[model samples]
Structures are given as structure tokens and as C-alpha cells.
Target: MSYITGFLTPVKTENKERYIESARKSWPLFQGYGATAQIENWGVDVPDGKVTSFPMAVKLEDGEAVVFSWLVWPDKKTADDAWARMQEDPAMANMDMPFDGKRMMWGGFETIFQN
Candidate 1:
């Protein structure tokens, strides 16, 4: 089964273009590292929650929007290895992060089911 690396980020609404560009620039690196696929989604109609929500989880600000993204890898080992090496790749090191790293959350998930 494939492995998944998911991300939830809070980015300035005005930086949407830069956000997409950053992802576009990073896609090749992920692919070179064995990622099979990648997806990036911009918030459209995300709602606020009374107790807990995507926005609340990231402490989203007034001018920021939440971005949901994921990358698919052949398996956990490939994903892990990719991540370890990606940290040292000069291309990755030089790519600009459009959003605040401190406000981003990510995790690797084992796929239980997928069509």
C-alpha cells in the first residue's frame, strides 16, 4: 500500500500565488525522491468550529487561509528515506517557503484503504 504524507498550513491569503509556486517548484524534488503523487488544495469554504477545527488547530489569522496537501509514496520506507534525504538536498534547501513553518502541521500516514 502507498504511504501518505499530509500537511495543513496557514498562509497569508495574499500569498496564494506564491504558495502555489512554492509547491510547483517542490514537486520535482518530491518526485525525484520517489513520491508517486502530490496534491495541494486551497481553502474555499472552510468553516469555523466552536470547539475544534482546521482553522483552530493552526491558529489561523484574519488574513490567512488554510491549505490542505498530501503526497503519496510507494511505502513508508521510501517516504521516510525521501524525507531524510530531502533535508539535505540543495534544491529543497534553497526553495522558498511561502507560509510560516511554525504554523504548519504534517504527518505520515499508512494507507489502510484507497480506491
Candidate 2:
């Protein structure tokens, strides 16, 4: 099974374009090192527990659109090893992160379905 790292975060709407451009630049950098990175932008059409079905997570003065992303690897061990090496890579040493890491939610997900 393929190993995957998932990242979920909020991105400033006004900064969305900039964020994606940064990601495009970064993705190839990782691909050169054998990691496949993919990004997705998410918008809430309804609050988590609401019934009226309205867009709740809009781009407010202090809020942002949610982003969900993933990094693909061949397997768990490969992912782990690659991540360790990536941490030590000088190319990533002083990277200017495209989003606010403090507000980001991320994790590894075990794949259960695929075509």
C-alpha cells in the first residue's frame, strides 16, 4: 500500500494565489528527491454541525479557506526514510513556509481504497 502524509490547514483567501505559487515551486523540488506532493483548496459549504447548509468558513478578516493536501510515498518505511533525509536536506533547511504552520493540522493516513 502507498503511504500518505495529509495536511489540513486554513489559508488566507487573499494569499491563496501566492500560497499555490509557492507550492508549485516547492512540489518540483520534492519530486526531484522522489516524493510526490499534491495540494487541494477546500471551502466549507456548511458548518460542521449546522443544518441550514451555508458556507461557514469564509475568508474573513481573521479567517481563511481550508486547504487539504497530501504527499505520496511508496510505503511507510520509504516515507519515513525519505522524510528523515528531507529533514536533513539543505534545500529545506531555510525554506520559507507558504502557510502558517502553527495553525496547520496534519497527519499520515493509511490508504483504504484506490482505483
Candidate 3:
């Protein structure tokens, strides 16, 4: 099964370009560490909910948008190794995030199905 890491974050609407640039800069590290694929989705048609929703999940604020992203690895071992390496890589040590890290959410999953 493929290993996937998913991320949900709230980013300033005005920082979209900065965010994309950050992703572009970080892609090589992921590729070198065995990530097979990566996707970054900007929120469109996202709605606010009284109870819960994507926006609420990240505590979306004015002039902010939700970003859904994921990275796929060949297997858990490769993903694990990549994560460990990222922590030690100088390339990532000062990587600037265009959004608030405190509000970002992420997790790893073992993909059970894919087209």
C-alpha cells in the first residue's frame, strides 16, 4: 500500500503565490526522499458551517483560505525515512511557511484504495 501524508491548513488569501513558491521549493526534498507524488489544492466553494467544516477545522479567518495537500510515498518505510531525513536536512531547517503553523493539521495514512 502507498503511504500518504495529508495536510489541512489555513492560509492568508493574499499569500497564495508565496505558498505556491514554498511548495515548489520544497518539492525536490520530497522527491529525493522517495515521495512519488504531491498535490496542493486551494479551497474553492468552501462553506462556513455552524457546527463544523473544512474552514472551521482550521479556524479559518478573514482573508484566509483552506489548503488541502498530500504527499504520496511508495511505502511506509520510505515515508518514515523521508520524515526523519527532513527533520535533519538543512534545506528544511528554515523553510518559511506562508501560513500559521499552529493552525496546520496533518497526518499519515496507509492508502487502502486508489484509482
Task: State the lDDT of candidate 2 residue by residue for 19-109, as single tens digits.
Answer: 8777776787667656765656565652543542212332223556667678887777777777788888887776666566766767777
Across 86-113, the per-residue lDDT of candidate 3 in tens digits comes to: 9999989989789998999999999998
**TM-score rank order:** 1, 3, 2
For model 1, the stretches where C-alpha displacement exceeds 4 angstroms are: none
Cα-lDDT of candidate 2: 0.67
The TM-score between candidate 3 and the true structure equals 0.96
lDDT at 106, model 1: 99
Q: Assess every candidate by TM-score.
A: 0.97, 0.76, 0.96
Q: How many backbone clashes does candidate 3 have?
A: 0
Error of 1 at 30 (Å): 0.3
Root-mean-square deviation (CA) per prediction: 0.7, 3.9, 0.9
Worst 10 residues of 3 by lDDT: 88-97
Please give the clash total of every predicted structure, in order: 0, 0, 0
The best candidate by TM-score is 1
Q: Locate the minimum summed-lDDT window of 10 residues in model 1.
A: 86-95
